[model samples]
Target: MKKTISREALKSASLEYNDVSGDFNWIKKRRGPIKVGQKAGSINHAGYVVIKIDQMKFMAHVLVWFLKTGEWPTLDIDHINGIKTDNRFQNLRHVTRSVNLQNQRKAHPNNHTGLIGVNKKGPKRFLALIQIDGIQKSVGTFENAIDAHNAYIEAKRKGHPGNTL
Candidate 1:
């Protein structure tokens, strides 16, 4: 039977993947000789050898040890912040993709008035409106774009985290 990992074991495994002395643990070593269908293993600066087993990448030897001893975590490890490659356990968590996306700040530009709002009179002023439960509700309007944006933000904070006007 295939071995699964426990939560404690996963945590322990995660620690070895991090640097004991330094704040970061996932640093790219001299990039060389990585290919598909090959399990290349190496000793990280954190003082542990990381190897790929059965097409799975472990951050460190301890992570593989956890795989041998416990079940795999149900959720994918996510970086709470927007970083893509940082693998510190404290920065990592088991979360659904939607939850992770919700926790993230808007990265895309093109949001006029610095918030969700509608432009009027050739962009002279903006009126903010948000849709909640399929109903469009006017948040407010402002002479200045920034003020309109602030109003939109306030409305968002009041229980409309997903509101976009």
Candidate 2:
């Protein structure tokens, strides 16, 4: 496990927090003093904000978790709104991997049906399915994608934690 930094140490390091954006600003001595409320951290390849401290990289959301709760999160830090860059405290939560996947975007770029968990079984029919405990369970087959998606949604609501819809 990675070593966790304490809130006191983080504060003493001259890292200022913006409650509104849930970001941390590092006061670099060479860059001169930064303006108050200025946002810091760089967007990583995965779209998450990363801050470097003492040569160690920390995710901004995870840092926010530690700053707010005074302890490291035991589970995954999920962006509740599904926007990876939106690190607002109100839009973040600690949830299991399964729960995090449940709240993902409705569809991926490769999805041809334009709906999650729904696939075309025939020219006019669609099949709805969901994964529970790593097992795929079929919800049912329907004439339209909407019906199939509804069934998938119903199954997700029943089996997936933190499901909003």
Candidate 3:
């Protein structure tokens, strides 16, 4: 609800949002580097689209929610399909922190396995684990990394099959 740009101001400023394509565009020329009809926003470090106006920056998803609903949201926005830059209205949802974490598609920074939820338990053993209801629980150990990964996926499926690392 804070730092809100009114819908009218948004239309006069950023111009339009293509709901189907999830793309925003400038309708009129601006004073600086932006040109009319140019695409708005750029991918930030964490892979989300960011838009800047009047020296203030906004997350495109947040803006989309605000523009679509005419009210700012107070909860985390989860990209249902796990694609950070896909801002399609249908692909976004408001969820609690735990639900948002459930849909996370990236491995933790400390996770060394190329596959998420699997880790090397020892020199030759691979361990599979998953987070359920916010608690991390072990699935099983395997001699092959792929098996460990599969075990993790199966464990994850038992919880929420729509999302996997």
Candidate 4:
């Protein structure tokens, strides 16, 4: 199993965090292509930044949270703008897993309507659905997808964990 990393360990390591820009710079040279003062992370397969320290891989956003606050996050870190690689301190929020999922910037790939929670109900109506406390609640039918989406956003504003609206 991989060992759990601590904030103090990262603070003493070779990385220097740039909170405003969300960039990590190498503070010292290391073996095999790593150089002093170079950017210290790469875009991972999921589009988030990942950096390797002492053979252990860590998400750059997590590192930023750790370094900036001096406390490892106990919950999910959300990128408010939906760009996973953008880890600027102001863009990051420490939230619950539900809130993290709710703040997504894009509709699901399988969503045919191109708007989150809005689906075609019939020939001239749309359905709006939202998740609240693990329940999929229907908001109501609407004439257009935008209206349905607005209903969903309104429901989210009420109490949905994401509250990104």
lDDT of 2 by residue, 37-150 (tens): 456778999899987776688898998888888879999899987888788888889888778778866687777899998998999999998888889999999999999998
Residue 91 displacement (Å), model 1: 3.6
Model 1 regions more than 4 Å off: 1-16, 19-79, 83-86, 92-98, 107-122, 131-136, 160-165
The lDDT, on a scale of 0 to 1, for candidate 2 is 0.82
Superposed by TM-score, candidate 4 places the C-alpha of residue 104 at a distance from the truth, in angstroms, of 2.2
Best by TM-score: 3
* Model 3, runs deviating above 4 Å: 160-165
Stretches of candidate 4 above 4 Å error?
A: 1-3
Query: Candidates' lDDT values, in order?
Result: 0.48, 0.82, 0.82, 0.84
Candidate 1 similarity to native, TM-score: 0.44
Candidate 1 lDDT at 1 equals 43
**Best-to-worst ranking by TM-score:** 3, 4, 2, 1
TM-score of 2: 0.83
Model 3, span 1-165: residue lDDT tens:
468777787767745899898888888787789888898989999899999877778899988888888877888887888888888999888877766777766678888887788899898999998878668899999998889988887788788644534
Task: Highest lDDT: give the candidate number.
Answer: 4
Cα RMSD of all models vs. native, in order, equals: 9.1, 2.6, 2.1, 2.2
TM of each candidate vs. truth: 0.44, 0.83, 0.88, 0.86
Pairs in clash, predicted candidate 3: none
lDDT of 3 at 122: 92
